[model samples]
Target: MNGFKKFLFRGNLVELAVAVVVGAAFSGLVTAFVNSFIGPLIALVGGKPDFSDLAFTVNGTKFPYGGFLTALISFLIMAVVIYFLVVLPVAKLLERLIKAEEATERPCPHCLSDIPIKATRCKFCTSDLATAPTP
Candidate 1:
């Protein structure tokens, strides 16, 4: 029970659960957007807003290819929205955060080569830096 509890409350498990919930919510919103707005735009071009209802009968069997098309469009729209909205912004934020830290890197005293602030010895020049103070 203790081990199960630990696993249940683990950081990754919680994060994944949250992610799944958010993703489901986002998917719903995207689906709504496509149905409400994009569907009309599609209707303007074609009589049908969604292809889900458009199907053909073959040998008295219905092939619902329209539903597949609708699902495909939904998936594509969701992917585009996630990439442009979430992924791009998050990546830019991470890049900015990393750039700030990278800008603070100190150079090696002996070789003038770039080194981390906490580095005690210069990797480029092999300088012994026993007395060197981190800035």
Candidate 2:
């Protein structure tokens, strides 16, 4: 019971559950967007709102390639939306954070180790830093 409680309360598991829920919700939103907006846009250009009815008969067997095309378009749109709206912004934010963190530290010249920017001595090599050139 204790192990079960620990597992249930674990941070990673909770985060994963939240991510799954959010992803499902996002998928619904994207699907709706594709159906409502993208479908109409494609219809305007291609004269068809959907490709589900498109199929080819080969050797008395039918292959519906249009559905595959529609799905592929939806997947591409979702990829682009996620990349521009979510991934690109997150990457930029992380870059800014890394720069901010780097600003608070400097390399210890004598030891070539990272130390506080204002440090006057190299803790690792026990070398005096006052005479060292600041890069």
Candidate 3:
């Protein structure tokens, strides 16, 4: 039971929950913006751009093409906003942090092993080499 609890309530789970909440909030914001601003603007230009009404009946069923377009636009806007506002910055920040964590002082050219940056000779082989940046 303890192991199960630990597995279910890990850091990744918390992060996933946060991400879901943020995504929902962001999607809601984009949908509100599109409904309030873009929808009216498009309606003004195209003469009543309500997707719900811009459909046709075939046989007995109506195909809601305009609603589909509205949904598609909302999805696109949400994706673009999340990509630019969250994913890109977080990826770049993680990359920089990883690079900083992996950085070393230097390495010995003689033995091709890690050594102190200011060392005059390779600690393993005891060979003095020209002072230069480690490859």
Q: Which model scores highest in TM-score?
A: 2
What's the CA error at residue 18 for candidate 1, in Å? Answer: 2.1
Instruction: Give the TM-scores of the predictions, in the order they appear.
Output: 0.65, 0.76, 0.56
Instruction: Please give, for residues 46-128, the per-residue lDDT of candidate 1 as tens digits.
Output: 77767888789999999989999988877787677678877999999999998777455677777888887777888889897
Clashing pairs in 1: none
Q: What's the C-alpha lDDT at position 65 in model 1?
A: 92
lDDT of each prediction vs. the true structure?
0.81, 0.83, 0.78
Using lDDT, give the best candidate's number. Answer: 2
lDDT of 3 by residue, 30-49 (tens): 77876787678778987764
Runs of candidate 2 with Cα error greater than 4 angstroms are 93-102, 131-135
lDDT score, residue 111, model 1?
83
lDDT of 2 by residue, 1-135 (tens): 999999999999999999999999998987787778877887899798767778999999999998998788778877887788789999999999987764766788767898877778878897888864464
Worst 10 residues of 2 by lDDT: 126-135
The C-alpha RMSD of each candidate to the native structure, in angstroms, is 5.1, 2.8, 4.9
